[model samples]
Target: MAKTKKNVNEMSFLDHLEELRWHLIRAVIAVFIAAIAAFIAKGFIFDTLIFGPTKPTFFTYDILCSISQSLGLDDSFCFNEAAFEIQSRTMAGQFSAHMWTAITAGFIIAFPYVLYELWKFISPGLHPNERKHSRGFIIISSILFFLGVLFGYYVICPLSINFLGTYQVSDKVHNDFDLSSYISLIRSSVLACGLIFELPIIIYFLAKVGVITPEFLRKYRKFALIIVLVVSAIITPPDIASQVIVAIPVLILYEVSIFIARFVTKRQNSKALKNV
Candidate 1:
């Protein structure tokens, strides 16, 4: 490790850029390799996972249906099937969607290794203490990302597909969605939620750098709630219940981020006092 550190320290700016280029190349290679696997497993990727939400017997639909039935509410969640047709208009549309979907899946599956490569590139510049403090960064970030992806896939995607699929302006209008549109919805939801779930990590780093404090987070709590609600509304069905369900977790994350900020600030202050 010391020898590796010495090599890093001796590297010129151009050499550093070259090293970064190699890391990026390796990351891209990892993604492409995973994409090949996904492409080979077309049935599982397309039928089992991507199109699961459009089916009536999807897990989220069944659970929500039971809840609605128990509560004697409207049977919005008890639909038979999503009232939409996905078609490829252009000649290469289906092929293009397939390749892109596999690539996106590849990136999602290979995210941890990509993060590792990125961490490797940056860790050489960090102090040993800083590196030690962030030992669990990759693992924790990966877990959060996977959780967010699951939530988006199981909850948000289903809700959006259900609502938008059945929506109709008139009897004359049909909901024939483009194949790319459907894939885009799933991809965006999963990726967006994955990144959003890294809130605590982002806050911790910002606090460590003295950019934000817990007090700032507490002061802006109300604004954060409003923003969460808006985001929830955007991602979920028009129903208040769905919006509340989505907002609850995000609000909890915000509170957790505040706590993380507080912890980082306290640690930094203690270290400063020790140095004095």
Candidate 2:
């Protein structure tokens, strides 16, 4: 039997649109199911997950304190309190917040299935060899995403919460944080880091398509470092120590992506030569 290769580029406009519609429909269904589950788990979602990092007794704080003691460093990780209280300013605010929170939670939980669906839609258009080589797309992308989310939650969220929550202008005023503001920090940190962690995957495909070169990455590495630090600073605390910590992992990922692209391009060239 002939391989059923569908050349999507050769399809008519309506056909292309129809194919895209199915991919989107599947992704939406996955998200909806995950959201409904999250909505029903109000206890675990709100108290355990959302408020976990903000507390002094959170696991991240405890682990950091242990490390600090081992290193003979002052208890930099110790926080007596966040010094802020969250509240709703209007009617329906709490209800609106709950609905939106569940939706965001749904998207996060459904991320892996969402990526799998997207890969399925795009893979049919790839050459057979390309598809075979990228067979681990769903697994690899999902791992990267989870790593990013963990980094955001354990590193970024804690730092931001500690800094902003503790900062005070005057003794006359108290910190009464809005519910929306609290949720936005968690949402942005998790989502932003999740996307940023896909640098390797993005660079891999770009290189496969001849859009990026390892040599180019090496040539502009110093510039890339500057950009990474700037991004880290924008998202993290203004302190040099916090910025450095965030930038280090990202820089490592960028360097790793360069190596991946080099290996991929070399493999592609070798295959071409063998064919010739």
Candidate 3:
């Protein structure tokens, strides 16, 4: 006869670890498969997406230029051409960048699958009601992540590239960025924003576990604002406009997280009252 699977409560610690290992293995395999697909689409991934912000005709530039012109502002937002040149200084630089970029793209493409794997591992330990309440976790998180990625690519990346690429202290100095450096900027912006946009989901879990409450978030709203600004400054170019643009959505997310925490707390309280 086949061995029966043990319930989560009956499983030994090592068995739990083994279960986790399998989930992680499956997630990694999914990522690798996605990465392979990304590797095969090098032209679209690099020329059309990764290097898109560096072009003068990028969507972000054209929009910003149009807005600036309509508002009667200076031509600072308009770009005739990108001033900096990207070069591979080392023999393996281009190859290494290509490989890493593919991996990053793979992780992004397979994000929902990864979350599904993670949910499968954790759901077994949760009550049926808890699991039911969180049925939309993977979908909601994936949507937020993709939205953040789009925002970073269309707003932050172009702003940073335009500013840094054209800025020169003196006419004698020219900006010649390395291939890895340029890719790194794009990768970091996309991934960081994606993760940052998961703030509401993270807050929901913390509230469910009683680690935080809406009151706590409300109390620290000022500090959160400061932290958001600081984080915006770190991720974006050192300019007020870029920082403000990045900070707006994050601040909105923080407020939404507070509302979520409040809802979770109210549900928990009502459930407790019903059991009394």
Estimate TM-scores for all models. Answer: 0.95, 0.93, 0.96
Give the whole-model CA lDDT for all candidates, comma-separated: 0.91, 0.87, 0.91
| Candidate 1 lDDT by residue in tens digits, 12-101 | 787788788888999999999999999989999999999999999898998988998998988887768778899889999988988999
User: Model 2 off-target regions past 4 Å?
Assistant: 1-10, 68-76
- Tens-place lDDT digits, model 2, residues 1-90: 012234666677677667777878989999999999999998998899888888898877777677768878776566667799999898
lDDT of 3 at 232: 88
Question: How many clashes would you count in candidate 3?
Answer: 0
Please rank every candidate by TM-score, starting with the best: 3, 1, 2
The regions of model 1 sitting more than 4 angstroms off are: 1-9
lDDT ranking, high to low: 3, 1, 2
lDDT of 3 by residue, 1-276 (tens): 011168778888888888888889999999999999999999999999999998887878888898889988787777779898999999999889989999999999999999999998899889999999999999999999999889888987888888888999999999999999999999988998899999999999999999999999999999999999999888777877678889999999999999999999999999999999
